[model samples]
Target: MSSITLYSLDGCPFCEKVHDALDDADIAYETEWVEPLHSDRNEVKRVSGQRAVPVLVNENSGVMMAESDKIVQYVEQSLA
Candidate 1:
């Protein structure tokens, strides 16, 4: 399985949807909460070029994508 990482924040319906998809698919992912505790969130900003939740990073393919639907589709494809 590929290494998947997700940057998420609380109270985001989109992030919750992505999380639900991952859980439904039984896919494992590392999560990083890009909250205020993160002083240096440059990686998240760099990957997305902005602060966004549910930032899916595919380490196997070195691809970073933002957008719940796209992220879900990419996860499905990667798992397949």
Candidate 2:
């Protein structure tokens, strides 16, 4: 597994933004597709303490966060 893991849901624009950033940066990461319903996103909640898509977990850096813009910026500044 890659050092980074992105938690995302299908059709989530925010998730797409992060995905694009990672792809553009040529960062090697894994995607964990989350459940469509927030209530069903137990793994996401467990990791990030919330049921939100576009969560990023960087095992190498020990950074676990949520939010697309921040994640993109992080990728640019750190991962990229």
**Residue-by-residue lDDT tens digits, candidate 2, 11-73:** 999999999999999999999999999999999999999998889999988999899999999
lDDT of 1 by residue, 1-80 (tens): 54888888777789888988888889888887777444566678977787767798878888889999998897677764
Q: Cα deviation in Å at residue 55, candidate 2?
A: 0.3
Residue 29, model 2: Cα distance from true site in angstroms:
0.6
Regions more than 4 Å wrong, model 1: 36-41
lDDT to native, each model: 0.81, 0.94
Please state the error at residue 36 of candidate 1 in Å.
6.2
As a whole number from 0 to 100, the lDDT of residue 27 in candidate 1 is 86
TM-score per candidate? 0.79, 0.98
The model with the greatest lDDT is 2
**Model 2 clashing residue pairs (backbone):** none
